[model samples]
Target: MQTTLMIYDGTAPADSGVPRTGGVPLAPAGFTWPICGSSCGGPLQFFAHLPVEDGVLSVFVCQNDPGACESWDATSGANRVYLFPREELQPVEAPATGVTLLPATSAIRTHVVTLDPAEDDDHDELAPDAYDLARSGWKREPEERFGKQREVLGSLGGSPSYLEDDRLPACPACTDTMEFAAHLEEGISAQSAMNLGGRLGYVFVCRACREGAFLTD
Candidate 1:
């Protein structure tokens, strides 16, 4: 059975240039994703994703003042979108409805497209299985849903890479959100039992506000 997933796309504030979206709460973390690093600019919000074409890239905007780094224009160059193979996507079980994220195989071919401003987002005609795959990559599937604690902890070796859906940090100075700066392939872990899967994401602070961002992979 295929399940569906919900993903968000939004821009970071001018001070912090971290792009972000909403996700199911993960206990202590509350409403947040990975912060890239310090020296990020402003706060970022989740807007929407590009269409299935051209790799299904997600889009984020910079709501900072024009006087700031003008991240809105700078962010145009970022590879914010991603496309995943059908096998890599996962079906999340909704506790309330008991319905999975992807209800059918059609979800594997799904992609998202977000319009601007976000104030008027309406999926009136969208099917129930849209946004089935939240993360890409072969390893992301089991790790995200069923990977053991040790798997996530011990796997944090080698290079580091940022996940397309990570919640980057916002700027502290001007409060603009930061953008996806770069990905890290390798990373180290604190303990063997602390595996969130070997893969990890790194977000950077916005260049304009110098705030911190988060990373994911």
Candidate 2:
């Protein structure tokens, strides 16, 4: 099994304002901060700014109280995600009011890892995010076993992990079910993980409404 490999030195960089995944969040000329509808009633915290096909996927979540807030409740208004056309976008300044940007931005590089069935017949049985399984397999193999680690599950273009299929969210605009967009996890390396405070963030969007949502668990 060949999987996407990410280089994790734990130093992901962002643009001047937003924490970098692919740079700044692109919005129209008169863009304003996304209001958090959660009990926090503040600006949703900026989570990621990923580049999509000809557009940018901007993500944010509520940070009123990491201990008591429902950052994962879809209707709690704790999170927001948006995909804007690149041509119609511009860099955004971090809001002065809401959740503050993380201090360290861990950078990530995506590559690939090739798995050889010959290495271990049981290698085929490992789950996608099976870190323990992969580590065990490596311990049994000779030196220089698998290519780079498949890396943790949450990075650009990868499916969200730790989520139930039935939990797919609905788009607030069209009232139609939204599509699973991406997952944002701790940054590149364990040392510089995006400082998500151990919570995994998920991004969803409705192209028809040009709106998106984010949640954490």
Candidate 3:
């Protein structure tokens, strides 16, 4: 069965040139850089800094040795998602080199959508490069359902919070069940987008463990 979901997209903020890989938090005080998984033994790649009504959502991922580290496994300790309080938010220090932070702070509106075949069939069954396979048939259709809202994150709703349910990941830190944190799709352009391997990246966070996970499919 093909389940339909309404997702949203909006303009991204201008780049501030802060290197995201192993970058500091946006908060002015009382925050530290999130630790990458055991695979890297170093800092994770800063993905995005999304601001919402509640607070700022900071994201990080592991791009080092992506082809070898089971990078798509949510529990692989390759990703981190943090929801920081806006009151304590501040600018982060940029690094000298490497990929920098993504521009997504100004999420203005939402766009609702539904797919013809759910776009992710055969989800439970493991397939090589399953994430890419699931989205292979994607195309821009004129009939795409659109809506407007103030939602930034959590605007899209579905299994595992607007993503495929089977793609739900566990917390690598505690081996406990994880919860959906955000849904990352392609952006308007390359400079300010989440290049999620041409598929949707589902971000999960184990609030209990203070750990995060990421997967794309």
Candidate 4:
């Protein structure tokens, strides 16, 4: 797991002034800014710093994995970067003026893999944000479906990992608790090693009542 910081200038907004042609003023060394996700070969570079509504300028790290370690350093990082003028960053539709552009919604897609015990403790903390993004999708730039990570679930017969969408037996409609769905005789993904954390079992809502929780092996 890698961490990136979002730095926005607190100063006031102004018209397109002189282009600040240089690297960002600050960021952690070796942080990889994401232009897109690993699956899409993203976590791309920032063309340049962007100015926001209140004359605020902002910078952020790319969360994509393939471009994880890439940076804007003169020596180590790539030279070509992306920069969007304030006017260009404005809203396409009316009543939504003065909003900064983010990575395209499609570009923000990620797989927030939940972990079971003895897998990777370091990743558990990172699960929520990643999972939220994977399930609901992003709201900012490049409008598109963030989409579900249903593809990540795969099948239970071969792999040992389980996806929250598949394991958390909730009523698809109201999300009420469901009954026990089933336990796989074999592993699902690498994460099926533990019975806790919604792995090892399948839960479902009452066909009528529709309420459920996970039952692990």
Candidate 5:
């Protein structure tokens, strides 16, 4: 299976327009910073800025009260995903209060990884999850296992890792099942990672409707 992994490339300018996590989000003019519509009702924390084929995927989640707001559910209103046009996007002004951004801006670079099906003799024993396999095999050196795993910012394109069928989100605009867009890891460093309560973040989008969804698992 072929999986495109997003690797950390150190710090980047907040509005560099490159694929990254943290930093201020770039949006069209008149764009207002998203606020959590769930329980906390505070400004949502910016999670990522991902450049995709058609546009950029801007993500946000409520950090005001993690578990209390249900940011892990796509339709809960505590999280949001937007597919913004690549051009004409400007850095958005952040709110004065709430967790609106991470402590550091993390740059990302993509690496395509192909996992040979023939390499595993126990393939039949377990259902293969491409994202998990790719992440486990991302080490640069044989002994770099755990350390290298931290460098994985997430992935660009691939099936959702271990996501259940029913958990797939429906596009808010058209009510159609959204296509999997990306998977986001917490981050490279504990201090800079988006607070996900130790779970993985999932992004989905409906190209036809230009809508997106965010959830955690």
Candidate 6:
């Protein structure tokens, strides 16, 4: 299987239209900052600005009180994902009183990775997850294993890594199962990493409905 890995590409302009994490989101006019409805009742923190094939995926998660809010559940309202059109998108004005943005804006560059089938072994009964296999083999230098893993921002257009079938989200507009869109990692450093409770983040979308969902695992 092939997966497009999102590699960390250093700091970027906060409002640039590029695949990136931790930046002010670009949205259509009249779009207001999404507030965390599940808990904390404050604005959700902007997580990423991903430019996908058909549109941009703007993600937000509750940071005001991470543990207090159910950000890991797709329907919990503590997190949000917007599928906005590519044209006429402008930077949103963040709310002044809540955790609405990240400390830094980190750019991302795509690297297409192809994974070969796992060798026949006792564990071959179950098919290997492509994303997991690709991620594990990302580091080229054995000595820089852990350090190189940190450069992986996430991946695009691949199956969710280790996500359970039951956790897949349904489209709010049509109630249909959504397609997996991307996997997001915390980040390269503690100072800018998204506080995901040491978990991986997932994004899903329903193309026909032009809707999206967010969750963590």
Q: In terms of TM-score, which candidate is strongest?
A: 5
Off by over 4 Å in 5: 121-124, 140-147
Which prediction has the highest lDDT against the true structure? 5
lDDT minimum window of 10 residues, candidate 1: 99-108
Q: Which scores better on lDDT, 4 or 6?
A: 6
Residue 37 displacement (Å), model 1: 13
Order of quality (TM-score): 5, 6, 2, 3, 1, 4
Tens-place lDDT digits, model 5, residues 46-79: 9999999999999999998878999999998998
User: Could you give candidate 4's per-residue lDDT for residues 1-217 as a string of tens digits?
Assistant: 1111111222222222322212322222333343332233433332223222223232222323323333212112322222232343431211122112222110011222332333433346654433223223312234543433222221111121244434444454566645432222111223221112343322222445422222333
lDDT per residue, candidate 3, 1-217, as tens digits?
2222222234433443221212345764756555556466555667665554455567777655556455566656666677666675666664444344554433423333434444444444653232232223234343543322112222322344335556666666787777665566555455445556666667666666666667777
Q: Lowest-lDDT window of 10 residues in candidate 6?
A: 115-124
Candidates' C-alpha lDDT: 0.26, 0.59, 0.51, 0.27, 0.90, 0.89
Candidate achieving higher TM-score, 3 or 4: 3
The CA-based lDDT of model 5 is what?
A: 0.90
lDDT (C-alpha) at residue 203 in model 6: 95
Candidate 2 residue lDDT tens string, 1-217: 5444334434444563332543345577888877766576777666566666647787766665774567777777767777877675666777877564655554455544445545465546654443223323432336655534324435444455557776778877788888767666566454334435677667788887887877666
Off by over 4 Å in 6: 119-126, 142-147
In candidate 6, position 190 carries an lDDT of 82
Scored by Cα lDDT, where does model 2 land? 0.59
What TM-score, over all chains together, does every model reach? Answer: 0.22, 0.71, 0.58, 0.18, 0.95, 0.94
